[model samples]
Target: MFLGYHILTKFFKNGELSNDSPKESYLYYEKNAIDGDLQGIIQKLDYLKELGIDLIYLGPIFKSKTTHGYDITNYFSISENISSNSEEEAKAIFAKLIENAHKRGIKVIIDLVLNHASKEFDFDSVPKNLSVKTESPRSPQEERWQMSFLFWNLDDEDTREFLIRVGEYWLKNFELDGFRLDHALGLPLNFLEEFSIRMKKIKKDVTILGEVWEDEGDKLKNFNLLKKFKGNDAQRFTSMFDFATYDTIKEVLGKKNGSLLELYNQIVLSNQLNEKEFQLTYFIENHDLPRFIDICQDIETFYITLGLLMALTGNVMLEYGNEIALKGDQTIHNFHESGRVAMKFKEDWSEQEKKTFNYCKNLVDLRKVHSSLSSGSYELINSEENLLIFKKKTTYDEIKVLIYTGEQAYQLDKEYFDLISNNKVLKLKRGIYYLQ
Candidate 1:
C-alpha cells in the first residue's frame, strides 16, 4: 500500500540552486528530466529493480530553471529544458519508459506541488497583485486567521481556480500513475479532498501520496502549519512522510539506549489511524538527512535500522544515492534538502557499501514475500533499553518476529528463523549477541 523513494536521481540538488551538470556536481543537473537524458537514468533502473523496488517516487521534474524543479512553470508537458515538448517525442519517451518499467513491473509517481505555483508560472494574477480581505466568515481560507497559510493568499478565489486547473491538466495530459504532493501541509484540505476525488474520476487507479510532516507532539495533532480550527484540514492527503518515525530514529541514533518507550509509543500511534491513512514513508536518513551509514557509525546498526523499516507496514523511501554511501552537508534553505551532496558514480563502490546495499535489497524482498509485514496485525513483543522486538501476524497463523538492538544479541522465542539466513530456530532470554 505504501510506495517509496525520494528526490529522484534526476532532480537532486545541493547548496544554492545552479544549472550545473551532474558531472560537475553529482546531485546537480541542467534542465533534464526522464525524457531528456533517457540513457542516463536508464542505466540506474537496474539498481532499483535489483532492490525489489516496484514503486518509484520522483521529485518535481517539470519545466524549471532551478536545479531542483519545485518551481514549476508548466504542468501539461515535460520541461522544455529537459526534453522537446512535441507530443510525438513526449509520448515516445513516456511509452518507452513505461514499457521498460512494466516489463519489470514497476510503477512511477511524480511529485506535484499544488500549494503554490512558481513565481514565473504563467498565471496572470500573481500572489503580489492579490489583496487579502475577509469575504466570507466561514470560508475555508477566511476561517484560518491568515489569508494565506502558505505562499499566496488563499482568500483569492482566482488563485485557487488556477491551481485546480493545473491539477486537472496534468491528470488528463500525462496519465501519471500517481502523485506525491509537495508541502501537503500548505495545501488547503478541501482542495486536496476534491483533487483526490477528481483524480479517481480521471483514472480509477491513480494513487495520491502527500508529503505531510509530523507536528511536534507525541500524539497526532494538527499537521505542521495546518490550521484545523480555521478549516485548513491538511490531513486530506492520502499518506504523509514519516517525520514522526524519523524524529524518533534521529534521537535514538544520537543517544545510545534512549527513549525506547517513546519509539514504541510512536509506532502504536501510527497503527491507530485508518488503514488508508495508516501508511507512512519511513527512512532513517533521506535526501534531507545525513547518510545512514554516517549516522550509525557502523554497518551493523544500519542493518538493524533497515530491518526495522522493512518490518513495519508502511511505504518506505530509500533515497536514490544513499545506497552507494553518498554523503554531504545537504541542508539547503536551512536544511530543507539536508543530504543533497554531490555524488561520485564513476568511483567504484566499497565492498562494505555493496553489502549494505544487498542487505536493504533482501529486506525489501522479504517484506514483499511476507503479507503480514504489509497488512498490519502487529504488536510489540519486547522493548528494552538495548533490545527491541515486534511481531506481525497476517492471518493468525502467519507470523513474523523482528528483533534487533545496539546491545549484544538477545534471545528470541523458539521457532523464529534468522531472517538474514533462514536456518536454526532462535531462542531469547540468553546472553549478549553483539549487534555490531
Candidate 2:
C-alpha cells in the first residue's frame, strides 16, 4: 500500500517560473535553474513524509542544456544550475541527500534517459564506434523549443557498455535505490535484459520501472510491446507505470461514456495477480500528462477519481504538485511547462486545494491501516449502471469498494461505512465507498 511520489526537480518550488534564464541560450529558457537561487529539494524532505509517501521518484538530474534534463550531456556529473556549487560539489551534495533520505525511510529512484543525449555531449570521451545520428522527434509541437538529441546506437557493443556504466555509477556511488528507465517501449529485448542485470548487480534490490505504453496507438494495450520488458525471476524489470488503465480512468470522469469495467479488465489482463514476475504502478497524473483536477472539471468528481485510483490493486505514484491540484496542459508550443509546474505548500492553499490534499492524504492513510487494501487480491463483485463494486481480500481480511460515477441519485444495498466521511450510512450516491 506504499505510495510513490514524482518530483520535477527544477519546478518544485512555488515561484519557479520567476527563475527562468535572464539571457536565452536556446529556443526556450530554463524554468528554475539558470544562475538561479531556488532552494534544492533536500530542504523539503519533510514535505514527502507528510503526504504518506514511501518512495520518491525524481525526474532527470544529469547535466543538460534544457530545464528538463532528459537530454543529458554528461551522465557522470550533476547539473550545474540545480545548485550554486561546482560540478564536484553538486555530486557530493546529491550523495548526502541520499544518506538523509535513507535515514527517514524514504527510498529514492531517478529517471534514466537512455534513448538519447544532448547534441552538446563531448563525443571524444567515448570510443570511436559511435557516430552522430539524428532521428525524427516524437512530439511535433515541442520540436523547435526542444534541444537536438543524438540517438544512441543500441546495436553497438561499445555503446551498451558505456550506457550501462552510467546506471552502475549512481548505485555504486550514491547508494541510490533504483531507476525509472525513460522511453523504455519496444527496446531490443536483449539490451533491456542486460541493462536490468547490470543495475541489480550493483544493488540486488534495485527497482527498474519501464515506461512501456503506446497511448497514440489504442486502449487495448500492446502486449507485443509490454512482453519485451517482462522477464523471469532472475532478471526482469520490477514494475511498469500503468498508462493504459489511467487512460480509462480519464474516460469515466464527468459522467463520460467510458466505464470502470474497462479499467478493471485492463489490470486483470495486464499481469494476472498470480503472475508474480511483474507488477503495475497506477497513477492519475504525472509530469507528462494533464493534471487530474483539470481533466475532472468538478471538485467532487476529482476526489472520486483520486479515490478510485488509490483503491486499485497495485502501486501508486503522486506527482509533486498533484497534492494541491496543480494545473498544466501539454501543447505544441509549451509542452514541458504544461505539466511541470511548481509545488504549493500549506501556508498558501485555497479551500479546494486543502480539501484535495486532505482527501488524498485520507486515501493514503486508509491503505496503510487496511491490509486488504494493500497486499490483498482483487475480484469484481458487481457493476450495475453507474455503480461498480470490487473486492480486495486476503485469507482473513476482506474489504469491498463501491463507486458511483454516474449523474443523479444512487441507492445503497445495505448499511455501509463511508471511508471518506468516517461514518456509517444506508444511502449513497455519486461517490466512493469502502466497506469491511
Give the top-scoring candidate (TM-score).
Answer: 2
List the pairs of residues colliding in candidate 1. 330-338, 408-433, 408-434, 409-433, 409-434, 411-428, 412-427, 412-428
Tens-place lDDT digits, model 2, residues 269-325: 753622454567778887766677767777777777777777776678888877777
List runs of model 2 lying over 4 Å from the truth.
14-27, 30-39, 124-147, 222-224, 271-274, 329-337
Poorest lDDT segment (10 consecutive residues) of candidate 1: 225-234
lDDT of each: 0.56, 0.71
Error of 1 at 155 (Å): 3.5
- lDDT string for model 1 (228-334, tens) is 31222223545566666667666675334366566767766665453554355666665445666666666566666666677667677777655555554533443
Q: Cα deviation of 73 in candidate 2 (Å)?
A: 0.7
List TM-scores for all candidates, in order. 0.77, 0.89
Clashing residue pairs in all predictions, respectively, total 8, 0
